[model samples]
Target: MILLGIVLAGAAVCVAVGIIADNTAPATLTVFGQHVPGVSSEAQVFVAGVIVAIFFVMGLAISSLALGRSMRVRQELRDLREEREESLTALELERQQLQRELARARGNQRPTTADIPVAGHRKRDQDPVSPFFDQSA
Candidate 1:
Protein backbone atom coordinates (compact mmCIF):
# COMPACT_ATOMS: atom_id res chain seq x y z
CA MET A 1 0.00 0.00 0.00
CA ILE A 2 2.84 2.40 0.76
CA LEU A 3 4.45 1.63 -2.56
CA LEU A 4 1.14 2.16 -4.36
CA GLY A 5 0.64 5.51 -2.66
CA ILE A 6 4.15 6.63 -3.56
CA VAL A 7 3.62 5.61 -7.17
CA LEU A 8 0.30 7.42 -7.40
CA ALA A 9 1.76 10.57 -5.83
CA GLY A 10 4.66 10.56 -8.31
CA ALA A 11 2.18 10.18 -11.19
CA ALA A 12 0.11 13.11 -9.91
CA VAL A 13 3.22 15.29 -9.65
CA CYS A 14 4.22 14.40 -13.17
CA VAL A 15 0.76 15.23 -14.52
CA ALA A 16 0.61 18.54 -12.66
CA VAL A 17 4.06 19.53 -13.91
CA GLY A 18 3.10 18.62 -17.48
CA ILE A 19 -0.08 20.71 -17.33
CA ILE A 20 1.76 23.72 -15.83
CA ALA A 21 4.51 23.53 -18.44
CA ASP A 22 2.07 23.25 -21.31
CA ASN A 23 -0.04 26.21 -20.24
CA THR A 24 2.27 29.21 -20.76
CA ALA A 25 -0.51 31.73 -21.41
CA PRO A 26 -0.59 34.67 -18.96
CA ALA A 27 -3.54 34.47 -16.57
CA THR A 28 -4.83 36.55 -13.67
CA LEU A 29 -6.91 35.61 -10.63
CA THR A 30 -9.85 37.70 -9.41
CA VAL A 31 -11.08 37.22 -5.85
CA PHE A 32 -14.00 39.31 -4.50
CA GLY A 33 -13.73 41.63 -7.59
CA GLN A 34 -10.03 42.33 -6.95
CA HIS A 35 -7.31 41.22 -9.41
CA VAL A 36 -4.44 39.34 -7.77
CA PRO A 37 -1.19 40.42 -9.39
CA GLY A 38 1.95 38.46 -10.34
CA VAL A 39 0.48 34.95 -9.73
CA SER A 40 -0.23 32.79 -12.76
CA SER A 41 -3.16 30.39 -13.27
CA GLU A 42 -0.78 27.43 -13.15
CA ALA A 43 0.61 28.55 -9.80
CA GLN A 44 -2.88 28.89 -8.38
CA VAL A 45 -3.81 25.43 -9.63
CA PHE A 46 -0.60 24.00 -8.15
CA VAL A 47 -1.27 25.63 -4.81
CA ALA A 48 -4.77 24.26 -4.78
CA GLY A 49 -3.46 20.80 -5.57
CA VAL A 50 -0.87 21.09 -2.81
CA ILE A 51 -3.59 22.09 -0.29
CA VAL A 52 -5.68 19.11 -1.35
CA ALA A 53 -2.69 16.79 -0.98
CA ILE A 54 -1.98 18.15 2.50
CA PHE A 55 -5.57 17.45 3.53
CA PHE A 56 -5.35 13.96 2.07
CA VAL A 57 -2.14 13.23 3.97
CA MET A 58 -3.67 14.61 7.17
CA GLY A 59 -6.70 12.35 6.75
CA LEU A 60 -4.50 9.30 6.21
CA ALA A 61 -2.46 10.12 9.31
CA ILE A 62 -5.56 10.59 11.44
CA SER A 63 -7.09 7.34 10.23
CA SER A 64 -3.88 5.40 10.85
CA LEU A 65 -3.68 6.79 14.39
CA ALA A 66 -7.28 5.82 15.05
CA LEU A 67 -6.64 2.31 13.72
CA GLY A 68 -3.60 1.96 15.96
CA ARG A 69 -5.56 3.09 19.03
CA SER A 70 -8.42 0.70 18.31
CA MET A 71 -6.01 -2.21 17.85
CA ARG A 72 -4.31 -1.40 21.17
CA VAL A 73 -7.66 -1.25 22.91
CA ARG A 74 -8.67 -4.60 21.46
CA GLN A 75 -5.44 -6.16 22.65
CA GLU A 76 -5.95 -4.76 26.15
CA LEU A 77 -9.49 -6.12 26.24
CA ARG A 78 -8.26 -9.57 25.21
CA ASP A 79 -5.63 -9.49 27.95
CA LEU A 80 -8.24 -8.50 30.51
CA ARG A 81 -10.53 -11.35 29.43
CA GLU A 82 -7.67 -13.86 29.73
CA GLU A 83 -6.76 -12.50 33.15
CA ARG A 84 -10.38 -12.78 34.27
CA GLU A 85 -10.57 -16.40 33.08
CA GLU A 86 -7.34 -17.24 34.93
CA SER A 87 -8.66 -15.61 38.09
CA LEU A 88 -11.92 -17.55 37.86
CA THR A 89 -10.05 -20.82 37.33
CA ALA A 90 -7.79 -20.16 40.30
CA LEU A 91 -10.77 -19.31 42.50
CA GLU A 92 -12.56 -22.50 41.45
CA LEU A 93 -9.50 -24.60 42.28
CA GLU A 94 -9.20 -22.95 45.68
CA ARG A 95 -12.89 -23.54 46.38
CA GLN A 96 -12.53 -27.22 45.51
CA GLN A 97 -9.50 -27.50 47.78
CA LEU A 98 -11.41 -25.89 50.64
CA GLN A 99 -14.33 -28.28 50.08
CA ARG A 100 -12.00 -31.29 50.21
CA GLU A 101 -10.41 -30.02 53.39
CA LEU A 102 -13.85 -29.48 54.96
CA ALA A 103 -14.91 -33.02 54.05
CA ARG A 104 -11.69 -34.45 55.47
CA ALA A 105 -12.09 -32.51 58.74
CA ARG A 106 -15.68 -33.71 59.10
CA GLY A 107 -14.56 -37.33 58.52
CA ASN A 108 -11.96 -37.05 61.29
CA GLN A 109 -14.56 -36.01 63.90
CA ARG A 110 -16.90 -38.20 65.98
CA PRO A 111 -20.65 -37.60 65.95
CA THR A 112 -22.10 -36.47 69.31
CA THR A 113 -25.69 -36.69 70.63
CA ALA A 114 -25.98 -32.91 70.37
CA ASP A 115 -25.32 -33.18 66.61
CA ILE A 116 -28.54 -35.25 66.21
CA PRO A 117 -32.06 -33.92 66.80
CA VAL A 118 -34.63 -35.98 68.77
CA ALA A 119 -38.06 -36.79 67.39
CA GLY A 120 -40.99 -34.70 68.72
CA HIS A 121 -38.70 -32.56 70.88
CA ARG A 122 -37.39 -29.04 70.34
CA LYS A 123 -33.73 -28.34 71.27
CA ARG A 124 -34.76 -26.07 74.21
CA ASP A 125 -36.78 -28.99 75.75
CA GLN A 126 -33.71 -31.20 75.70
CA ASP A 127 -31.69 -28.97 78.03
CA PRO A 128 -31.06 -30.26 81.59
CA VAL A 129 -33.00 -28.41 84.29
CA SER A 130 -33.90 -28.79 87.95
CA PRO A 131 -36.81 -31.14 88.73
CA PHE A 132 -38.38 -28.40 90.91
CA PHE A 133 -38.83 -26.20 87.86
CA ASP A 134 -41.67 -28.18 86.20
CA GLN A 135 -40.58 -27.62 82.56
CA SER A 136 -43.42 -29.79 81.25
CA ALA A 137 -45.95 -27.29 82.57
Candidate 2:
Protein backbone atom coordinates (compact mmCIF):
# COMPACT_ATOMS: atom_id res chain seq x y z
CA MET A 1 0.00 0.00 0.00
CA ILE A 2 2.79 2.39 0.82
CA LEU A 3 4.47 1.55 -2.47
CA LEU A 4 1.28 2.39 -4.32
CA GLY A 5 1.09 5.74 -2.55
CA ILE A 6 4.71 6.55 -3.44
CA VAL A 7 4.19 5.64 -7.12
CA LEU A 8 1.04 7.74 -7.32
CA ALA A 9 2.83 10.69 -5.76
CA GLY A 10 5.71 10.31 -8.22
CA ALA A 11 3.28 10.30 -11.16
CA ALA A 12 1.54 13.40 -9.84
CA VAL A 13 4.86 15.25 -9.50
CA CYS A 14 5.87 14.23 -13.01
CA VAL A 15 2.61 15.55 -14.47
CA ALA A 16 2.84 18.80 -12.52
CA VAL A 17 6.40 19.41 -13.65
CA GLY A 18 5.49 18.61 -17.27
CA ILE A 19 2.59 21.08 -17.13
CA ILE A 20 4.76 23.82 -15.65
CA ALA A 21 7.51 23.24 -18.20
CA ASP A 22 5.02 23.44 -21.07
CA ASN A 23 3.79 26.86 -19.82
CA THR A 24 7.33 28.31 -19.54
CA ALA A 25 9.31 29.97 -22.35
CA PRO A 26 11.89 28.03 -24.33
CA ALA A 27 15.45 28.47 -23.06
CA THR A 28 18.70 27.96 -24.95
CA LEU A 29 20.82 25.16 -23.48
CA THR A 30 24.56 24.86 -24.25
CA VAL A 31 26.65 21.75 -23.57
CA PHE A 32 30.42 22.21 -23.63
CA GLY A 33 29.80 25.66 -25.27
CA GLN A 34 27.97 23.82 -28.08
CA HIS A 35 24.31 24.69 -28.75
CA VAL A 36 21.97 21.63 -28.48
CA PRO A 37 18.67 22.00 -30.32
CA GLY A 38 15.49 20.08 -31.20
CA VAL A 39 14.99 18.94 -27.55
CA SER A 40 12.43 20.70 -25.38
CA SER A 41 12.93 21.18 -21.61
CA GLU A 42 9.55 19.55 -20.94
CA ALA A 43 10.61 16.37 -22.73
CA GLN A 44 13.87 16.18 -20.74
CA VAL A 45 12.08 16.73 -17.45
CA PHE A 46 9.46 14.09 -18.33
CA VAL A 47 12.15 11.56 -19.24
CA ALA A 48 14.03 12.22 -15.98
CA GLY A 49 10.81 11.70 -14.02
CA VAL A 50 10.20 8.37 -15.76
CA ILE A 51 13.76 7.22 -14.97
CA VAL A 52 13.24 8.15 -11.30
CA ALA A 53 9.98 6.22 -11.13
CA ILE A 54 11.57 3.14 -12.70
CA PHE A 55 14.38 3.20 -10.10
CA PHE A 56 11.87 3.52 -7.27
CA VAL A 57 9.84 0.57 -8.49
CA MET A 58 12.98 -1.53 -8.88
CA GLY A 59 14.02 -0.76 -5.31
CA LEU A 60 10.61 -1.77 -4.01
CA ALA A 61 10.73 -5.03 -5.92
CA ILE A 62 14.16 -5.96 -4.55
CA SER A 63 13.03 -5.23 -1.01
CA SER A 64 9.93 -7.39 -1.49
CA LEU A 65 12.02 -10.33 -2.75
CA ALA A 66 14.39 -10.08 0.22
CA LEU A 67 11.46 -9.97 2.64
CA GLY A 68 9.92 -13.09 1.10
CA ARG A 69 13.20 -15.02 1.29
CA SER A 70 13.69 -14.17 4.95
CA MET A 71 10.15 -15.25 5.79
CA ARG A 72 10.70 -18.61 4.10
CA VAL A 73 13.91 -19.18 5.98
CA ARG A 74 12.25 -18.36 9.26
CA GLN A 75 9.41 -20.80 8.60
CA GLU A 76 11.85 -23.58 7.75
CA LEU A 77 13.74 -23.00 11.00
CA ARG A 78 10.52 -23.16 12.98
CA ASP A 79 9.55 -26.48 11.37
CA LEU A 80 12.99 -27.94 12.14
CA ARG A 81 12.72 -26.90 15.76
CA GLU A 82 9.30 -28.52 16.08
CA GLU A 83 10.57 -31.77 14.56
CA ARG A 84 13.54 -31.87 16.94
CA GLU A 85 11.26 -31.34 19.92
CA GLU A 86 8.92 -34.16 18.83
CA SER A 87 11.80 -36.58 18.32
CA LEU A 88 13.27 -35.72 21.70
CA THR A 89 9.94 -36.38 23.38
CA ALA A 90 9.64 -39.73 21.65
CA LEU A 91 13.17 -40.75 22.66
CA GLU A 92 12.49 -39.84 26.28
CA LEU A 93 9.36 -42.00 26.28
CA GLU A 94 11.26 -44.93 24.74
CA ARG A 95 13.99 -44.60 27.37
CA GLN A 96 11.44 -44.69 30.22
CA GLN A 97 9.82 -47.83 28.78
CA LEU A 98 13.17 -49.57 28.47
CA GLN A 99 14.06 -48.73 32.08
CA ARG A 100 10.75 -50.20 33.28
CA GLU A 101 11.35 -53.38 31.28
CA LEU A 102 14.84 -53.78 32.72
CA ALA A 103 13.53 -53.35 36.26
CA ARG A 104 10.83 -56.02 35.72
CA ALA A 105 13.36 -58.45 34.22
CA ARG A 106 15.65 -58.02 37.22
CA GLY A 107 12.81 -58.81 39.69
CA ASN A 108 9.75 -57.12 41.30
CA GLN A 109 11.82 -55.22 43.84
CA ARG A 110 12.20 -51.63 42.73
CA PRO A 111 14.18 -49.22 44.91
CA THR A 112 11.97 -46.48 46.31
CA THR A 113 14.85 -44.07 46.57
CA ALA A 114 18.15 -43.45 44.76
CA ASP A 115 21.53 -44.49 46.27
CA ILE A 116 21.95 -40.94 47.51
CA PRO A 117 20.99 -40.57 51.21
CA VAL A 118 17.87 -38.63 52.24
CA ALA A 119 17.57 -36.35 55.28
CA GLY A 120 16.90 -38.07 58.69
CA HIS A 121 17.63 -41.52 57.24
CA ARG A 122 19.96 -44.05 58.95
CA LYS A 123 22.77 -45.65 56.92
CA ARG A 124 23.46 -49.39 57.46
CA ASP A 125 26.22 -51.67 56.06
CA GLN A 126 24.20 -54.93 56.43
CA ASP A 127 23.76 -56.79 53.13
CA PRO A 128 20.20 -57.49 51.97
CA VAL A 129 21.27 -60.95 50.65
CA SER A 130 24.03 -63.23 52.06
CA PRO A 131 27.08 -63.62 49.74
CA PHE A 132 27.08 -67.48 50.18
CA PHE A 133 23.40 -67.83 49.09
CA ASP A 134 22.71 -68.54 45.39
CA GLN A 135 20.36 -70.75 43.34
CA SER A 136 23.22 -73.18 42.44
CA ALA A 137 24.33 -73.43 46.10
> How does each model score on lDDT?
0.66, 0.65
- Span of 10 residues, lowest total lDDT, candidate 2: 27-36
What is residue 48's positional error in candidate 1, in angstroms? 1.7
RMSD of 1: 9.6
Tell me the tens digit of each residue's lDDT in model 1 across 1-137. Answer: 44444555565565445545554454644443444466577677567558647655655566666667779999999999999999999999999998889878899575689778778776866667788997676
* Regions more than 4 Å wrong, model 2: 1-39, 114-122, 126-137
Displacement of residue 111 (Cα, Å) in model 2 is 1.1
RMSD of each: 9.6, 9.8
Q: Score every model by TM-score.
A: 0.51, 0.55
Q: Pick the candidate with the highest TM-score.
A: 2
Encode model 2's per-residue lDDT on 1-137: one tens digit a residue: 44554565566565445545554444433333444465467677456457656766665666676667779999999999999999999999999999999999989667766666778765555335576764555
Off by over 4 Å in 1: 1-39, 108-137
